[model samples]
Target chain A: MTATNSFFHPAFFYIALAMVLPFIRGRFYYWRWLLLVPSVVAIISVISMDHGTYMVIPWLGHDLILGRVDRLSIVFAHVFAIMSLIGFIYGFHLKEKAHHIAATLYVGGSFGCVFAGDYLTLFVFWELMSMASVFLVWLRRNPVSTRAGFRYFFFHAVGGLLLLAGLLYRYYAVGTFAFTAVDPSNAQFYDYLIMAGFCVNTATIPLHAWLSDAYPEATVAGAVFMCAFTTKTAVYVLARGFSGFYILAVMGTLTAIYGVLYASIENNARRILSYHIISQVGYMVAGIGIGTLMTVNGAVAHAYAHILYKGLLFMGAGCLLYAAGTANLDKLGGLVGRIPLVMIGYMVGAVSISGMPFFNGFISKTMTIAGAAHAHYTWLAIGLEVAAVGTFLSVGIKLPYFAFWSKPIYKGELRPIPINMYIAMGIASGLCILQGVYPNVLYNLLPYPAEAMKYHPYTAWHLVQSFMLLSFTGLGFYFMRTVIAPHPGRNLDFDVLYRLIVNTFAFIICKPLAWMDNIWTNVYRIFGMRGLLGLGTGTKWFDLKGIDLVVDGTAYTVGDIGGVSAKAQTGRLQDYLAWTVIVALCVFAIVWWL
Target chain B: MRNWLGDWLEKTRIKHAKIWMGVFITIMAALVIFNLFIRPHHVEFGYDAYCGFWAVFGLGVCLLMVFVMKKIVQPFLAGPEDSYDSNE
Candidate 1:
């Protein structure tokens, strides 16, 4: 096949269409028809590509491979394409052309990063994702979102720089720019740096605060797109490159536990779900770290499942934010009867995330735990199980109970949500259930051969164990509902460290530097200007007296000598001859003496 | 019909909560009983195969987490929601 036919990268279509969206007049008509064109075309293009590298262009004396149509890239690209469609559906009612353009660019960036076969191409698209997604946060047009968007951009930029440095160093060391797996046992410093960059994007501990900090502050429709990409792309890269790395397994387990612990106390609905994203991605990371065929398959499968349900959850929260104007649980309650469809949709997502039986989470989450056990990582497996219980307690039970079923806290009129939003939620909700019931629907798309995964999620013991665990968790929540109740406050996170560093920077710039500048100005006034004035006066005196005295004295001496000579020369020739003879005698005597 | 369905749903809301709790308790009991009869394919981990082990583990961890988070952790971590907003 020709290069043009075989090498069509999906990202170009969205980017080109995004440029065209601004000029199309008539908001509703334009969006309803043309908004889905890029995603649809991308999906069609993805379906047609065969398994080989395409779009090879020489860049900076190196070959840049833009289309790597392998099984792994294809799986991630598939979900990204479908999720962009869902995102378009959810935000179809928006009249802002800027929002659609930003969303399209963000989606395009994700697709580009996933298909990139070279580190240079991946880094380019990685930054593109970062720059594009920040607009989603800024487009909210609130002071809070504006500030949060800057912080989000700042963190991602730092991550992108780290990746760029690593890629350059690795190129110098290995003499290639190919994106491939780093063997952790034999990795050099550049490999670790690259892994650190990937970890920040994955929202690992201590590097994770940017996610919960910015996601809740994003626009209602924008959060849906933000939820689907970024972290999952990091997971894809981690699974591809850093599998079998032991540190990821340990950190991923800690992230899972820490995420749910914070989600338990968090009051904002979107923030709670944001933390859960960290928790869910932890499973994928740990599974990749385990590095068995089964575990890797589990990780890949989980990412696919997570995108569906997490998008649904965020859409549900967006619905509440759209209708009730606030996502804080302390201020929201008794919304079930008011918006039954949203409640049901939210519950499906809640159950799926909590790993309840007959849901997608049950299928994917169990595989990771089983993989951990099968690999003899007993402590890691146990930690994940505890996190599972905590997950059910906080997100599955507490968040929804307070948001939908608890006593009425909000007394204002709820706004009417658009119908297209409901359709989007319905579509996501159906996928969550469909994949939950039929695991093969998702399993067949795994990078590993289907028969290699010898795990079954539908066994009687597995069902009984999962059900018992979730039920007991529900009972625990029922007993301690008041203790776990949402309050009007924020819980400290790693963002405390982020805030401390930022505040110290501001203090240095604002307070101490200003004080130093003030002192410098005063010193300049007291000594510098006064000293300069004194030097000027002294120079004026010296110029008038010191140099003038020497010149005037010389002139006076010459004038006196001239007057005497003039008097001698004027009288007579005889007097002049006598004077000349006397001068010659004086010169001869001086020469003789010397 | 719609009005009747809405009224019915509203009236049964509290009843639904109660019945849901009962059903949850019963399901827990049934699972604990079923664990006594069924054997897992993998017994490499002994505690996981025990009856009511998961139930106890799940309940214990959840209750401990809630208690520690609310009583111990939140007091240390809790601040006004706008605490960071002032810095911004």
Candidate 2:
């Protein structure tokens, strides 16, 4: 047998680039293009691979498939690779080799997970993703970011453990570690545990605080990468495995409302974006749980469109942070004059996410809401529409309006944004529009391509509804501007709850353990050591007095036998000749008798 | 081209800001009028078939979100931004 194109898994390209990056030490300035190579290569690789498992390894009586190439994984990996390429280009001006490496590994880890056909491989890559993202957060190298990184890591640690526990128990019960779809009706505790793990990454409410906590604190470029991967990858897994889980459906809707509400109150621009990620991901999550073919297809298609536009949004936010030295909406205003190109780029993202007609989000988000409504999930659909309204209010209008057009224009020194950053944002914006103008580009790649094709977003009603909806949302923002204007403070989230739990755990576990240790020390010092010494002495005595005598007797007997043999061997030559003669005569007599 | 656009945004747009606002209002009014002529492909819920249902819903939801979140929830959740840092 000969090797085929099976080695062309995109994960391999990303990880290999991560490994080779550190060696390109000083010339990183000119050689920065290397950062773009793996992603470009991955895009090509994802496109060329046919619909079959490509890289398979035999492991402990199961086939650990590394490349489960099908419509589902293909759609995700396709977008992931493209986003990674864009992320690198957006971060191109940074001289930090570590950032690129971490971002690459993070991207690689996501790809590994998307293609992993078994639980073990998925967990490994999932963990790799978690740690690499922590580094992305930590690369900012400030006290706040350090604290945020630790929190991010700690949350993921809990999530990874949940995934590990779930997968292990599942393997024990089912005798297989395959990462296939779960029948929601037959889902066990372990399945929910796995979903809980995915939920943490997906920014599902109550498990979602870590995202808004961490993303805003990450390095500018890192946030761009962070936004694109962590939650959406989790969405992929949920759509793959836990589709139709009612819990996800409820939680997703709540998250949609929850995220936008918090975003509406957020002072930090990046944090606002972070919260809106929850809102957008909520749409996908709800679609997954709705479980109809159209809804599922809607979820997958939304993820594809989301990666491009959201990455652009992050890049725009990053460019501001990179040049203006602040992402706080309170500090930002009238930046359109300083960075008009960025404003334009960001508006494209804003409009796209707001579900404006002919933008990518319209192509995907409406489908999910419509699918829910059509499926008679009236409340969920209504909840989703409310989220849509909030989305446009906060992100589409508020973030940009404050950052670029608000009164009292910032008089701070502005640095020139790297040309590459603009170029990358441009690329992502183009893709968002391209996918929007030609909806078929994204629709045909969905899991249910036929349903996707059958669903028309360009109907007269949809267009009218979208324009009116978005426009009124603008009007609402205008009316409520002073009420919703971002104030300079932190609004509490589940991170506060997490901190409470951790503090309570410390108090509950530590004081008792310390008391126990004190008691144990007192008990040991007084009696335990003496008891141990007495037992040791008895064993020593028994070994010396009881067991040694028999051994000594055997030695004496052996010595006596040696002495007798020595005495007998004193005149050896004559005795030896006599013994030989006797033996020979005995043999001859026996032979004659025979 | 970039500088020209930047100058326009800084100088010209702010001067004609009211015009832009008026333009936006015009677009909104036109949407409600158009909703009178075009019917929904399918109505899935109450009032969805009526003109201006979306407009009402959109405005209402946005207002409710701000009032609830900003007016109600923010007081409870808001803190000095460095609450965590100080706690740390």
Candidate 3:
């Protein structure tokens, strides 16, 4: 199963597809099947490929492993490829080349991340993932979406900088850019910086504000594609690198609770789901932080299951946005009457997310809790259990009840949901149920299959425990229904701090600097030139003729450059974000080239 | 297929709404009963060995989460829907 570092890398398929697809106009509309080609190839390539390294290049007295195939990477790659196929199918109706291209590159970036065997390679693809995804938010093409895209892009730029700094520091300290698991007891400052960077992507608590801030503003199918990649990639990296870190264990449980707390009050369907992404990712994170063989396997298994169900969930919500023109719970009701199949599809995702007895979440989520309990982390296990209750309440019961079954039945003229969206949902739903009923399908793909097989999800006691828990959660919702009813408002998270800091920086730093620069420029133009003209001497003729032509002209241009630097802070978020990504890419691209 | 299902749900399902509620109640009762008979093989936490610990845990936590989030925190936390769109 071993081989030299030269072969077809899986990411090449999506990368090639992105490059070739722009030329695929006209026929692209007729042969819509063309876009699905890369996903199929990627899946086959990922599934058929054995564990080995490929495409290793000696660079700067080091090696860059583009394809580091292992069971862990393969499992993530398997789900990414599968989700990519489903996402493309769901989005097939869109005529926008930008959507398909952005999605293609985004998927390619994730593939690059999954198989990346070196920090440098991973960081390059990491930025690619962030950059490609910003388009998904911006493609929504509204003022709100545009603003959210900037914020999303801004936070990821900061995160990418952190990772770059960490990796570079680690290379100098350890003398290698090799991406490997770190020993927790021996973890250094650079490790925490790197972990902090990865934590931002995982939506870990305070760092999580960007996800909820951005995702609800994304395009419908764009959200579905997004739901699979960003946080989960962070989970993959954390499981790979920062596994035994206790801060993650504590913070992870807190993040799980924190996400649900927000989802409880959120009115936007997509926003609610966005918060739950943080919550569900919390479990995987907790498992990784606990750092047991069982917990790590649980984390991976949960990730695999999560991609299927979460994608299905987003697809369901995306259909609502597509059909009803809104995913706001306050604006939606009795959707079951019109889009009953959507309700079914959505409920499949809903129950799956809730870890209802016969769903994928039940199988995967419990594995982590069981691992925590076995490891004697009593408080973490309890916190996760409480969070699970909140999960069932918000995502499972509250969301479905309000959106589908509640009164004031939606009497509006609803757009018909395309058949393709339903087909994609149906596929995801079937897999969720299949994996739930027969755990081996997912179990066999785990990093530690034999260890995972020993963890049963469907014992009589376990089933009773889950039903009793989720069913009673339903009952509690019945009593508290009026209290928890969705309302029209947004709750603040850490983004408020970010907004404050950014606004303050603009006010305190840029505005004054610009004001001073303008004053100085005016002073130079008014005083210096006026003094020269008033003198009316041979100096004026000399200044205007030769020295002025060269020196003063240079002085004015350089002065304007300073003014422009200061005045460039037009208090617009996009201004700050615009050149940042370009500069980031060019710098990294140069370093990568080197 | 979607049309048929949508029709049945709008018509038939609505007509049997109360019946469905009763069925849900019965299912809940059946679950509690089931928990009594099939206890965990070994209780990791001592309280989990109790017949209805998870039922109480689920109800208590769900209610707490709802009340705490919606009533307590949300009133403090929530703002206009367009809160973040200020720059826009």
Cα deviation of A494, candidate 1, in Å: 1.1
lDDT of 3: 0.85
**Segments in model 2 whose C-alpha atoms lie over 4 Å from true places:** A1-7, A26-28, A521-594
In the range A1-594, model 3's lDDT, one tens digit per residue, is 465533457678878877887787575486467779889988888778877888888875679889888899999999999999999999989988888889989999998988899998998899889989999998999867876776687689789889978887786688788999999999999999999999999999889999998999999989999999998888999998999788998899899989988899999999999999999999999999999989999899989989999999899999888888988898888888788888888899889988887789989999999999999998999999988998888889888888888887777878987889989999999999999889999999999999998988888998889988998899999999999989998888888777666555445654555555556456556667645655545544654575445544344333322223323222433444466557755665565565
Candidate 1 residue lDDT tens string, A448-471: 856434678999989888988898
Best-to-worst DockQ order: 3, 2, 1
**Candidate 1 vs. truth: CA RMSD?**
20.8
A390-416 in candidate 2: lDDT tens per residue?
999988999999999988788999989
Model 1 segments more than 4 A misplaced: A1-7, A451-453, A502-594, B1-8
Candidate 3's TM-score reads 0.90
Error of 1 at A495 (Å): 1.6
Fnat for the candidates in order: 0.66, 0.84, 0.84
The single-chain TM-score for chain B of candidate 1 is 0.77
